[model samples]
Target: MTINSAHRFEPGATVVRRDIFGDRVWTAAPRRVIEDRGDTLTLAHWPGVEGLAPTTYIDSLGMDSPAARDAARDQGFADLASGAWELGSWRWRDTTVLSRFQAGEHFSVHLFFGAGHRPLHWYINFELPFRRTALGIDTRDLLLDLLVEPDLSAHTWKDEDEYAQGRRLGIIDDALHAQVELARERALELLAERQETFPTSWLNWQPATDWPLPELPSFNGV
Candidate 1:
């Protein structure tokens, strides 16, 4: 699940990601480049990450110090409470409102994350906020809303072959099929929330203008 994009980076900014060891590593390019410098090594030591010792500050660059995190938290909290954030029927990242060039849409600053502007094929307004908030630092709420927490006893497949396998394995009966379907229905509710149509939204969008567009076959009282 590795993804690389031509990401915009700020000079002194750093980001951390969880590694295989369950330890946070400085994944930003500038930070890594500084780490390889000999003098920087002597200035700070990489304390082997383990239980109870989750974070190690970069004393050399005065980065990720407790003070720095606190400052960031303060700024974030201030932004969250600011009156500049507008309340609307649906929340959207401010950039998305502007970028989409919406004709009748509304927005609030609170709803927008700079990284969450990609459009999806489905229309679910409730889920739209979730998608827009997903790439931010705190995404638990969005993830939970989008995920269909599976019922362990429910049948996972509708096909006879799959049902038979479950029966043979002494798993739940095919009656569990309804439970799976119920889960699926909830998932669809999430999808219908965003009301945009594919390849047709205002953002860099163009309608299919080819004349004599294919007409649908009539159902003719079938």
Candidate 2:
């Protein structure tokens, strides 16, 4: 799908992964656009909300801890005396951590970094071809994904049960299933040959400290 003329991102533009209701569930750290080559957009990582931590979800806090009460208040919950705190029992922290690489359309590749900025794994996400929308470039995650090691020596298919469940539930139509299968085949072929499309340099690549952090786009529906 073509990028919406009004929302085309240029190099250095900031973009966030579009989430429903601007939820901070998975994506909280925005990515700096490095290049916008129409069909492909390159993004560089920024420090996540957890700073440089390896994981995004913090362990749950105890229900009666002062920290938990403070966190509930900070998150806009009613006072502890009101007994309306949903997280009054526990708090699972969300963060914007890890490095990633995403290309639009067909098959989008994602690379994740571990602690100390070490290369972790590659995630191949099969999705609907991205389309530029009023809500930024939009694509639907197909649920089927392939996970690969940093050196491409080991790999595993992920979320097969989810994908099958989607199919059984009629959420994934035959056409979408075929498209995801094709993308998976192509990804396997690319990995078998050690193609340069996989950014091996990112294993050691670091963003310049002076670069500004990425900002989220406006969320007004058009």
Please name the candidate that would achieve the greatest TM-score relative to the true structure. Answer: 2
RMSD of 1: 24.5
Per-residue C-alpha lDDT of model 2 across residues 39-94, encoded as one tens digit per residue: 56666654441111102113223356767754533332121113222211111133
Best by lDDT: 2
| Model 1 / residue 170 / CA error / Å | 49
Task: Name the lDDT of candidate 1.
Answer: 0.23
TM-score of each: 0.17, 0.66
Per-residue lDDT tens digits for candidate 1, residues 1-222, read: 222222322322222211111122111110111121211110010112111111221221235566876554344223322312211111111232111111111110111112334422221111111111111110011101121111111122123443344344433235544443454465454334533321232334222233121111221111
Backbone collisions counted per model: 8, 1
Alpha-carbon deviation at 163 in model 2, angstroms: 0.7
- Worst-scoring 10-residue span by lDDT in model 2: 49-58
Taking every candidate in turn, the Cα RMSD to the unseen true structure, in Å, is 24.5, 8.7
